[model samples]
Target: MVQAYILIQTDMGRAGDVSAACAEIDGVVSAEDVTGGYDVIVKVEANTVDELGKLVLAKIQKVQGIVRTQTCTVVHV
Candidate 1:
């Protein structure tokens, strides 16, 4: 499986709702509101890298109040 961490930015006061919505997405393992440059951090997995991209674009990005996202694919050394 392909795994990634998605850092999300949302409009002010929307982090909690955004995180909760992301947590419900099929590929999302965990979604939490966080402090710092990003408002939410999500761990997700999919069958392939392309699938992971699709999930991020089609599902996670469409969550209400999201302003932006940065996806970091996991690497195993």
Candidate 2:
């Protein structure tokens, strides 16, 4: 399985809404509003890296109030 952390930057005052919306998407494991560089931190998992990319690009990025995103794939050594 492929897991990733999506750091989302939302439009001002929309962190909670964005987080909630993200949490509803199919591949999303969790979504929470946070402080610092990003407004929302979303944890998602997919069967493959390609699927993970699609989840972020097609679903998460399409959510309203999202301004930008940074995706970090999980790696265990």
Candidate 3:
């Protein structure tokens, strides 16, 4: 299984809503609103790297208030 963390940047003042929406998506295991360079952080898992990429691109990124995202795949080693 592929696992990744998605760092999201959203429109100002929309972090809470964005985080809530992210938590509802199929691949998102968890999501939280945070204070820092990014607005929200999401944990996701999929069958493959490409599938994870599509989940981020086609779903999470489509959520309202999301402005940009950075994905970091977890490395077991």
Candidate 4:
């Protein structure tokens, strides 16, 4: 599986709602409200890299309160 950590930014006071929505997405393993530049941090997995991109673009990004996201793909060396 392809795994990544998605750092999400949300509209002010919407972190809880955004994280909750992301947590329910099929590929999302976990989503939590967080502090710092990003509001929510999500762990997600998909069958392939393409699917990962799709999950981010077609699913997670579509969450109502999400403003922006940065995907950090996991790599094994």
Candidate 5:
């Protein structure tokens, strides 16, 4: 399985809205509003890298209030 953490940046004052929307997406395990350069952070998992990509690009990015995102895939040593 592939796992990733997506760091999301949203428009000012929209972090809660973004987190709420992202939480309902299929691949998103959890989304939380936090204080940092990014507004929301989401954890996601899928059976393949391609599927993970689709989850990030097609699903997560489509949520309203999101401005930008950086995806970090987990690597096992």
Candidate 6:
């Protein structure tokens, strides 16, 4: 399985709503509002790297308040 951490930025006052909505997506393991350069951080898993991309592009990016996102895929050495 492929796993990733998605860092999200949202419109003002929408971080909580965005985090809650992301947590409801199928591939998302967890989503939380945070303070820093990004507003929300989410953990997700998928069967493949392509699937992970789709989850971020097709699903997570479509959430109402999302302004931008950065996806960090996990690597095992």
Best-performing candidate as measured by lDDT: 6
TM-score of 3: 0.96
- Give per-residue CA lDDT, model 6, range 6-76, as digits (tens): 99999999999999999999999999999999999999999999999999999999999999999999997
Estimate every model's Cα lDDT from 0 to 1.
0.95, 0.95, 0.95, 0.94, 0.93, 0.96
Worst ten-residue run, lDDT, model 4? 68-77
Model 6 / residue 62 / CA error / Å = 0.2
Per-model TM-score on C-alpha atoms: 0.97, 0.97, 0.96, 0.96, 0.96, 0.97
Q: List the residue pairs that clash in candidate 5.
A: none
CA-only RMSD, every prediction: 1.0, 1.0, 1.0, 1.1, 1.1, 1.0
How far out, in Å, is residue 75 in model 2? 0.9
lDDT by residue for model 4 (1-77), tens: 88999999999999999999998899899999999999999999999999999999999999998889999999961
Model 5 regions more than 4 Å off: none
- Which stretches of candidate 1 lie above 4 Å from their native place? none
Candidate 3 stretches with Cα past 4 Å from truth are: none
* Model 6 spans > 4 angstroms off: none
Residues 1-77 of candidate 3: C-alpha lDDT, one tens digit per residue = 99999999999999999999999999899999999999999999999999998999999999999999999999992
Instruction: Give me the runs in candidate 2 sitting further than 4 Å from their true place.
Output: none
Q: For model 4, what is the C-alpha lDDT against the true structure?
A: 0.94
RMSD of 5: 1.1
